[model samples]
Target: MQKRILGVVGSPRKNGNTDILVSRVLAGASSVGALIKLIRLGDLDITECDGCHVCWQGEHCAKKDDMEELYREIIQSDGIVLGTPVYWYGPTALMKGFIDRLVFFNSPLHRGLIRGKSLMVVIPFEETDMNTVKPVIDFFDRCFTFLEMKLVEKLVVPGVSRKGEVVTKSEKWLREAFESGQKLGSGLT
Candidate 1:
């Protein structure tokens, strides 16, 4: 069977730089014969994880919301591409919430569900320096490691503030994102 890749856009702004980058990545993945699905978290009604520890008991989350569907998709996917815009030197609130909910996959009972899966992170920030996105990178690094997932790639595009600005100002970054997706789809990373 073909590999399935899921791209999750965590930016609240529709058609923002993060979303454009993710769309390009998914397009590249599709070009390489990988099945691609893009999920815009901003459009979903995913609630915050209640810290109930119900999933630790081998039971599903107590809340009924869009997260349940996302959990299913994540489990079924071979790889995941997470894209977010840097806000206050960190990932947006939507991204943070999504990451928090991922605890279910890391629960003791489902410990290995995410093992061996691949992950790619794309972050866009207004800061001109690449260092500005370091915190976000570090966050994902630790999270992915905890999940026993492979951190395949990290693409950080700097100096993009306005919507659609990346398209004109950061063509190279866009190409890099596409190439990273191609590599992931080809299983070369």
Candidate 2:
């Protein structure tokens, strides 16, 4: 069976660096026969997590929103590619909200739905210092670690601010992103 990869773009700017990078990764995955789907959080109606904790009791979240569909997609996907531009040394507000909603999977009843899935993260930042992206890396490391998900790859591009920079000026990083996707896609099979 072909592996399914979900590409979630957390950047609000469509066709921006994050979006392009995420698409490159998905394109790479597609080249290897992996089924890929892209989801732009900016286009969705994902609300902030209400902290109700109802999902902890094996019940669905109290708030009805697009997250319900996201849960289903996540459950069906064999791998995920999460791409976001850095905002205030962390993920964008859109990505953060999506991450918050992922708490539903923390429930023991739903943990199995996410454990062992492959994950690839793409982070593009405007800062020139490599250390500047550490917080973003650390944040994802903790979350995926706690969830028992295998982090297959990470493409962190620093010093990029303007749109299309990844494609225009960062050929090396773009190649790395594609290779990361190839590696991730091939590994699943």
Candidate 3:
């Protein structure tokens, strides 16, 4: 079987809370023989999106950096699993920066290629009520919908406050995230 899943971890901290959850989900996905590549954006030499419209000229973003490599992977994968923590009720800077760079995809040049892909989101938060996460959740959901992609699973594990605390403590939710990854690895319905 060909490997078909790509996991992107958008945390500035390598061993941060979000990274652990991302690792666990990848591990579970690998257990089922899915090819998994975990890209930790924090280690890359990336830059912010300058809102350049170069993507309209071609199917690729003109902003040069490590993100160019990631863009290739995004197009190659059958599924995209994003593991990110919400900061200030939104996506962390690392992820927001990457998404902003993807502004090129919003151009008509690349419209047809990115459509109908599958995405899974895993989020760990410190909010007291999981409901507070609605803002960020809806943000991602709407983006994917606008891009014409399918949302396979969304796991929001709240109440994890300490550094590197979510994966070990969120046994139940982590398992659910793993199962969600497995489901995504099986391909779209």
Candidate 4:
């Protein structure tokens, strides 16, 4: 069976710069024969993870929202990609909320189901400098590590301000993302 890659566009803006960049990465993964699925957060009714801790008991979130299905999709995936826009030096509010919901996968009971998953992060920010991007990537790394996931690559596209700048042109950072996806999708490493 082919390895599955789940690309989650955490930005609420559909097809925004971050979305397009992640799409390119997932497209490259598809080119390599990986099963790829791209989900736009804006279209989902994912609620913030309240302190309910309901999912810890192996129960779905009590909110009965789209997040349950999203989590199920992620549990079935082999590779994961997170796409987010930097706002005030961090992931967008929507992305943070989504990440918060991932707490369920951190528990030991689910580690067997979620461990060894490959992970990537795509950050689209107005700052193009690597130094400026490091913190954002660090945050993503922490999130992935918390789930015991293996993070292989990250794509931080800087100096992109407009919402749809990615569709008009590709950035050098995209090469790394595409290649990362190709390598992960190949499922050899």
Q: What lDDT would each prediction earn against the true structure?
A: 0.91, 0.88, 0.79, 0.81
Worst lDDT window (10 residues) for model 1? Answer: 105-114
Following a full C-alpha superposition, what root-mean-square deviation does model 4 have from the true structure? 1.7
> Mind sharing the TM-score for model 3?
0.92
Pairs with backbone N, CA or C atoms under 3 Å apart (clashes), candidate 3 = none
Q: Highest TM-score: which candidate?
A: 1
Off by over 4 Å in 1: none
Distance from true position, residue 69, model 4, in Å?
0.8
Point out where model 4 deviates above 4 Å. Answer: 167-171
Off by over 4 Å in 2: none
Q: Where is model 3 more than 4 Å wrong at Cα? A: none
Question: How would you order the candidates by TM-score, starting with the best?
Answer: 1, 2, 3, 4
- In angstroms, give how far residue 11 of model 2 lies from its true place: 0.5
Q: 1-189 in candidate 3: lDDT tens per residue?
A: 545778888878778777877777777777777888889888887798877787888767776789889888888887888888878888888888877776766788776666888888878888878767888789889888888888878878888867888756757977876777777666633
Question: What's the lDDT for residue 54 in model 3?
Answer: 79
Per-model TM against the reference: 0.97, 0.96, 0.92, 0.91
Alpha carbon lDDT at 78, candidate 1? 88
lDDT of 4 by residue, 1-189 (tens): 688999999888777888888888898899899999999888888777777876667655667888888878888998888889888888888888888877777666666778888888888887767777777788988877777788887777778888888655665666777888898788754
lDDT (C-alpha) at residue 153 in model 3: 80
Q: By the lDDT metric, which is better: model 2 or model 3?
A: 2
Q: On lDDT, who's better, 1 or 4? A: 1
